[model samples]
Target: MERGLTGRYEVTRTAEEAVRAFVPNPLPPEPPLDLSGERQRLLEQALLACGRLDGVSALLPDPDLFLYAYVRREAVLSSQIEGTQSSLSDLLLFELDEAPGVPFDDVVEVSNYVAALEHGMNRLREGFPISNRLLREMHEKLLARGRGVDKLPGEFRQTQNWIGGTRPGNAHYVPPPPADLADCMASLERFIHSDPKPFPDLINAALTHVQFETIHPFLDGNGRVGRLLIALMLHDAKVLRQPLLYLSLYFKQHRAEYYRLLDRVRQEGDWEAWLEFFLEGVTQTAGGAVETAHRLLALFQEDRNRLQDLGRSAANTLRIFNALCSRPIATIRDLEATTGVSYPTASKAIETLSELGIVRELTGRQRDRVYAYDRYLALLNEGTEPL
Candidate 1:
């Protein structure tokens, strides 16, 4: 077993003790209710907007703003948990492969975090069980690039880590010692695999998230990995098809209250209050994501129509435009491969877009120039940073 920071304490807690320790205090007294009429109407509006996003012929509003915000939020949340500092601007440039002065390793970590999230979501879509094996796979991906970290990649921690402080010596909360970790993890695995007491999916998510945090299973990447598990569980429960909902913003916004709620759950068994908080987060975050998706779809449609109006080569233009949605930055080489056009033809199509003010040259150099879907990126970045 690994030692604590002072080397004076060893981790030890039974799985049952661990669960009892982290459960919210003052368990909520009431069950979660269906959305009220007004809230239901709002959800319907959000769904309608999302539907427009899915429809091929629907007009799209500026979606890049929302995309940018979502991407930034993910970066910030994932990085914060791992103690990596990155700004929205830094994340934006990193995503574009234009970030300067940032270490390549840091960029790789961020990318891997995003990829893990996407992978988990895709697996959920295929209806795979959120097994311990799956969690290990994700953990492995998270730590695959670290140089010398002793915490085994893709495995539960055999050591102890603390939360809410710079060092374990000074941490506000010291989780169960390492000796107890195995039992704690086993109990969690049981919860995931078997139905326990009846609970709403949202409540189950909150309980699972809290328990994972308490377990702090991995020596590193526990916070990010735990949060990712929340999204995975939500999808597995059929709450959403995409890993689009994020609670980071809510937690970030209510940082103190978030922790307090968790503490209260453990101290008072207040599962009811915690469940309410979680459901509100769900309803709010989902509503916002739906809005963003609609906005993005609208922007895409408008751009498509603009290209159509230009009377550009219909097939070539559509191909290039759709490619930009997936890849905001592109080179002539990229276009040629994506469109199956000769280099010269690809260059011509790019020139046509440039002439029509649809694409902008991101790199001023004439040779091996890079073009950007500036508006699209901008839309994706919106509300991602503090105003």
Candidate 2:
């Protein structure tokens, strides 16, 4: 066994030992990857479900609206894993104006994290190769604002890190020592950019995720970082046009099972079962996202038609409505910034929308009042229920 230290904590490991030695047994059954005949049919059905989500997402009046919503959802989910109580609505409402007790700076950091992920996704869409540098950049964006003291933002671990538990003293698994960090990172880089072997992209994603988790490269934010890698890798592999499939909800819901399955792979080389769980997560999460997108689109179209019937100014109404779609909460300042209108014009647009019942005032304060795209936030929140 190899022994090392991170500060005062001790980490011990061996090359041939179980990947997660502290995790117990009774691993789940391995799943099969051969999607021939009936299996192939199931795979097609899952892809079709994902396609429907993309179609519905395309119906948004402004694609940036959906993109913004996605960023909030990603932040909320990533925060949840770390025991942060922020919700999808919290993120949306905070964007309009800072909330009491909630750190505005942290919110900005989270927004940038989401933006970095979106930027990475865009690069991947344009066929850019995934690199260690890209992952570090994303991590830096994610941890830009220090969450608390002693946790440096955006920097990698100078000491060793572990998984399966919170503190090093209580960790269930200690990965390769710092002396082996180079080999561990090289393995991860190979997994990311290397040619695909016999495994399907989804299966490969699950394996890569486990490997990254095992590596535990960062001091904090490993869980969130690992999840982000899943979305990016899937986009890079062309499995989805957008980084829309978020499995954190799935992982959080089945926390024990998730960890168990991951440990099973390292202990028993049980790739099949992990692949099945991942594929199932994709199918279910994709379906939920599709439903949510459809509902949001329907709501948008209905509201647009309503405004048109009222003989509203098409250009201004469309601009305000589109801004609300992207950001569920908005202020006159936001409307002015988005629509490039005078403050008075922006106020008039918001008042008109409020009168039309398309937007509702969230806060009663006269100055810097917040307006909510209730329907849009509802649809986005529907898919994200805390476990």
Candidate 3:
């Protein structure tokens, strides 16, 4: 049902032109979401997928190994939507201080994404609530050392900001003017912390994500932070044990439709359409994550079997293989530190793996060479091409 224009637009003057900036209403869309028939089925599937995704940790001997790469994969995909060009390998190489020709700023943005997500997860584990304060903290880490550093990292925008065009006059969307931010954000927080709980966890997350994006609270990292809010909210609400569900790939894949639905919710008051898309993304992404965990577990076991035949050299070689499982890209020194072996032992293990074709050298250089677990990365690199 089209409820028509979800919020009022306020006329605001900017440097070059005047525009009607949108200030969105708070959560629990008026008239309530119609979650009765097919919508109910979608929500049930999404929640069930999340339940399986939450228990996917059981599929791995060490879930962090998958989490480590999976999170970076998400960072790359998320940043790519904002026009960053860094790949998963580029990020891993950057963390090792060995990405000689990789785009520095792009990789920094992806790395900061990893750090920001970890910070948010850590804060949640320490009993912090998801509020404006924590969102600011995550935004701070996200822009700590990227192109947006000058855009005021940890604070909400104090000036008008628009999306898509050269100026607010012709922009695709203009978020709320600065003056409305405090009240808007506080209302959003209240919705999140409502005593009776306005909606179920999955529904609440969908509503919160849209409201936060409409608010567009931050100066530079709103898109990234808004995407992060979904994962954070799901994890905080006990929908998932690990902060693993990311819709960036889904949004990136269906870029046009995603934007259209967000606009529809604002203009036609079609919350049901947006919620349908959001639930589908959750179901697809969560199920995909579980499938990935299974594939990785199988890959690890297959690779271990391949190495078990190495006999005398298998001991040290398997140790390095374990390290590679956690980090698919590593230098000799990185493996050494991770495996607690001497430089020579790590180097020889690398040499043996090189001969076996289990790992390949990234750089042909005699020194500062990097190696990659090619097949493992191949799995994570799916659908991560820059948009």
> lDDT scores for all predictions?
0.63, 0.68, 0.91
Q: Which residue runs of candidate 3 sit more than 4 Å off their true CA positions? A: none
- Best prediction by TM-score: 3
lDDT of 2 at 370: 83
lDDT by residue (329-369, candidate 1, tens digit) is: 77888777887888887787788778867789866887977
Best first by lDDT, ranked:
3, 2, 1
What TM-score, over all chains together, does every model reach? Answer: 0.76, 0.82, 0.98
**lDDT over C-alpha atoms for residue 60 of model 2:** 57
TM-score of 2: 0.82
RMSD of 2: 5.9
Judged by TM-score relative to the true structure, which candidate is superior, 2 or 3?
3
Model 2, CA-based lDDT: 0.68
Pitting candidate 2 against candidate 3, the one with the higher lDDT is: 3
In model 1, which runs have C-alpha deviations exceeding 4 angstroms?
1-77, 80-101, 122-128, 147-149, 312-315
lDDT of 3 by residue, 1-387 (tens): 799999999998898678999989777788887999999999999999998998887566887888888899999999999999999988888888876355789999999999999999999999999999999999999999969899898999888988899899999999999999999999999999987887789899898888999999888988899999999999898888878899999999999999999999999999999989999999999999999999988888898998888778899999999999998998898989899999999999999888877899988899988999889999999999887
- The residue pairs in collision within model 3 are none
Q: Give the 10-residue window scoring lowest on summed lDDT in candidate 1.
A: 1-10
Question: Residue 8 in model 2: shift from native, Å?
Answer: 23
